[model samples]
Target chain A: MSNKVIEISNLGKQYRLGQVGTTTLSDDFKRWWYAFRGKEDPFLIIGDTNDRTKKGSSDYVWALKDINFSVNKGEVIGIIGKNGAGKSTLLKILSRTTAPTMGEYKIKGRIASLLEVGTGFHPDLTGRENVFLNGAILGMTKAEIRNKFDEIVDFSGVERYIDTPVKRYSSGMYVRLAFAVAAHLEPEILIVDEVLAVGDAEFQKKCLGKMKDVSGNGRTVLFVSHNMSAVNSLCTRCVYLKNGTVYSIGDTAKIVETYLSNESNAESCKVWDPSVAPGDSVARIISARVTDDKGLTIDHMLRDQKVGIEFEYEVLQEGHWPIPNLHVFNGSEEYAFVSVENELEYLSKKGKYRSVVWIPADLLNDGRYVFGLALTTMKPNVNVHFYAENVLQVEVIEDISKRNTSYNQRLPGVVRPQLNWETTLLSD
Target chain B: MADMKTEPDEEHWDLVVKPKSSLFTLNLAEVWAYKDLIMLMVKRDFTAIYKQTVLGPLWMFVQPLFTTAIYTFTFSTSAKLSTDGIPPILFYIMGQTFWNYFADCLNKTSGTFISNSAVFGKVYFPRLVMPFSVVISSLIKLGLQILLLMAFYLYYYFTTDQLHPQWTLALLPAYLLILGVFSLSLGILFSSFTTKYRDFTFLLTFAVQLLMFASCVVFPVSMYSEKVQNILMYNPVVSCMEAIKYSLTGHGLFSWYYLSFVLLVTFIFLIISVVIFNRTEKSFMDSV
Candidate 1:
């Protein structure tokens, strides 16, 4: 038998551009008239491509257009895209909460989607009642819920408050209980969209583990999330959507690398005109750049080589004692570290200056990173003249040839430094 | 050949979703498959409404009782309208009991899309489950209000000899089924329309209120002229209310032709409304 569980062919969804009522009655009549004559909808050919930023002339836009993909029985697919890139629209179509405007899809088994957790949970109902209610809303029979009632309660860890209305439960307990009911659902195909973004890290991990266990039993899973780390760990295959279309689909690591590199909108250098630069009268930023050790500007960094981040600014006034600082963040927005130029003294005269910080090799894990530049004064209540966030971003690629081990998995951490180690063979 | 082997026969796939389906494709099996969700929704509607209340489900009786008292005071005592020889309390309570059920079902289910947009936007089941469950839950209140009517029935039965519940009383369930289907159809019809234009929602509430006077809830249909009675029978609720009142008190018009007219209108509207509901549910998220 074929293992393919879902096959979507040329699926597309078109949406009206403005308020739903903006479509005139004449337009609806015209479309209906076309269809009544056994012809295609006249408006379908007039929609602009999906781009939320651009204001198109047409009143209809294709939120998703000409999409084709399929999923096997046991594969976990991650859908990654920028906001408004039709990720949610695609999931909604698969979940059957909405239908596409064109094309079709076939599924081989039972499908359940958690476009959101706690979908039908009523606040006035007790936690126990909500479990059964939400489970039924998720398509579980009453008897099926009864069979796993105890397990669901145990998993939620809210047994003491099971009989209390969920409105009285703390937010964390509510999510835990809601997620427990969903996790116990035994559908053959599951689609989750960012429900794991709730609760604390430990609860999220537990939910991920339950999903992994579900997939381990040969069930198919489709996950959509902007958290690349979670996607990297959970999804075996990745589908990258760009501007409401499938840009690539392949192995998880390869697609994730492409997505992260493409997401780095900033280049090695960003220069602003002095007249409109970001700063006050006392100081202003002129440019920011990322460079290699040889002083050549580069858009990316090598894991085994040194890199430098430099900020150039003009000081229009004297005696401000402005302090230059840089904040580094990893791909997941985790704070890496902050560096300050404490060794430089305050310049008594007005002039332009450049501050450079060299990042040691092996200090950053292989992924994407962003830099933020700011100029602040420590004296007189610590005033900041200007702070620019995400001034520059670059990708850190690992050099496989320089590796000392055969391990090929991505090392987890915000910072990966080569610390000194002393090993002695005392027995010999 | 190998690729062809991997792709199974068209009939093997369990579910196939399309953009549009025929108007007659009602999918009663899908609704049947979601029966558990229907029952759970019924339970939620019943239990959630009475939470934090002083008397809880007792309010079901309180509402119709007060409404009957007000109607009797307004129509019987003040206006001196004829109750067709039945006691004003018993007559108004009987008519209001069935009328309230229809009105309640219509009002509750009319907002099905807008009120439950949160749940509908995130999950997929048979969207019809909500309106179906609303009708079912109101049946509970309908049962309690009937008990209140029965209490007045016994009081008048012992104190006076004006009671004659005929063999036609056996048709009470049939009338209720007609009433339920009628209101549910109009409810969902308004719901689908309101999803796109909110005017229907505003139109529904006052329309149902105005519908009560035409349905002869507070007065007897006998008080109206022959031509007016003919026009009133076109309103499906009028025949149902007349049949239910006549069966209980032997004081209202009950004709098979009118009942069948009500049934046919309800059945046809039920088909149209359900089709519209199904079509709206597929894409209402974008508009709602």
Candidate 2:
């Protein structure tokens, strides 16, 4: 016999995206008629897969399309995607929470899913009762549950509140108990969604440890999350989805790299026009660009090189306001730094000002970053001018050979600028 | 390291390890396997009903007793309905006890999909377990109410010295069987519909109350005209209530042919309900 626990072939799921009314009824009839006659659905031909993110003319969207993969026994796979990328839909289909519109899958083991916490818990029932209820819902027999009941309660750390109704428990306590029952049930296959997004950091660590132990016991797991670091640490393989189709599948590091790079490339900056940007009082941002020191257009830059942003705008009136602000964001769309021209003080005498903001050499660390600019009235609590988002792109590079930084300083966060450091042996 | 390289054995496990067909078959063995869960659900429903209440389980007896008293006073004396030589209290209590079982089953079962959508959306089990648990839970209430009816029956039997009570009481099990079939089928059927059109949920309680009067819960079916009786017999619940009343006091007449007709109709309804429930379980979360 084969060791594969799940074999899926050409799995597809389509959904109608609109209010359920007469129009949908007629369309459903049409689709059902074609399906009855063993013909391809006529509506599926409207939009190509290349532009799935764009709103289509039809009211239907395929949530998953032609997905094919196989999972061997004991393999833990992480599924990653942005919002509306069909990651949840794929998990739902595999869990049998919903059926696919087309294709098939063969699952060779008992599957338990922790899609959400407190799923099977009744508000009026005690925590002790909910454990058994949730376990049975996951297909565990009473004797099997009885054998692990103490372990579940212990892992949950809610022993004192075991007989108290879950309704009174805090969300953290509830999730801890719920996840404990799910992970301890010992199913042959486990599916978990982003339920770890709840609970405290310490609880998240505990849940992750339990998941690792579960996968270590020769059971298969399919995990879906947006946390790249956790995915890197937990999964043996990774699948990246984009607009309901498998974009790539391979090793976790390679797949994450491909997904992140592709995401940045797909969001290529668009030219700005005053009419397209929304604002009330002040002048709007007409255009913005990033360039090298030689004034040549550049998308990527070295970590220790100079970078410049040129802002072009048309002033609505001669005003003492219109403070231009620049914000820089790291690859994950987190704001890295904000610089305001309010300190220039020279711009207070300007009319229809155009200027460039420059960063000197040897400042940023290695990473991709996007730049945004806004032209707003300097006064507080007032609606003003226009803002342009993700207008300029910059990339920083690192020399892999250099290894002087301490371990604590290597992690990525909101700040990546180098700072002066000195050490002295004072009393020795 | 050698133990780590060895593949885990799959044969020793009792879990269903084969690929399931999209069309699920009723696994009677699986239900047998999860019987403890069914028992737990039943216990939860029974004990939790009056958990925070002052009277606790005593309220179970009090509810049926008060309903029977009001029903005897209103239907027997005020409406002047004939009890067919049986005491009014015994006649009404018999009908009310059986009818409540049917109503409880229907009301609870109809809300099965909506009520358990959270659990169903998260995990996979025999979805049939939920509706089946409702039937089992309602049976507990039925058993309690029947015990109260027995208490009233003994009091009437000893003090009034009612004749012909022994023979009719022997048919009580058959009456309960018929009632069980009727309620289970109706509950599953309504549950399937309510999963789609939630408007039916609001109408369910009022529908049950209106159905109680038409099924002879408070009055005898013989009190109505023959035309009304014919119309009432078309309702499966009417046969169940009439069967229970006839079996308890030996008052109303019994018809095996009509009871068989009710059984056949109920069988067809149960088949339809199971089929719809199976299909709905696959995709109901989309609408819910």
TM-score for each predicted model, relative to the true structure: 0.95, 0.86
Please report the candidate that would top TM-score against the real structure: 1
Residue A244 local lDDT, model 1: 82
Candidate 1's TM-score reads: 0.95
User: For candidate 1, lDDT tens digit of each residue in A306-388?
Assistant: 89999899888987788889999987767899998883675435899999988889899998888989988888658787888
DockQ of each: 0.67, 0.36
lDDT of 1 by residue, B1-288 (tens): 246457556558988899987777778898898899898888888899999999998988888789888988999999999999999999988888888899989999999999999998899988899999999988877997888889999999899988888778999889999999999999998999898888897788789878888788888889999999999988888888888778887878889999998899899989989989988988888778
The ten-residue window of minimal lDDT in model 1 chain A covers A17-26
RMSD to true structure for each model, in Å: 2.4, 5.1
Give the Cα error of residue A31 in candidate 2, in Å: 6.5
lDDT by residue for model 2 (B149-189), tens: 88888888888855355365576666666677677777776
Q: Is the docking of candidate 2 incorrect, acceptable, medium or high quality?
A: acceptable
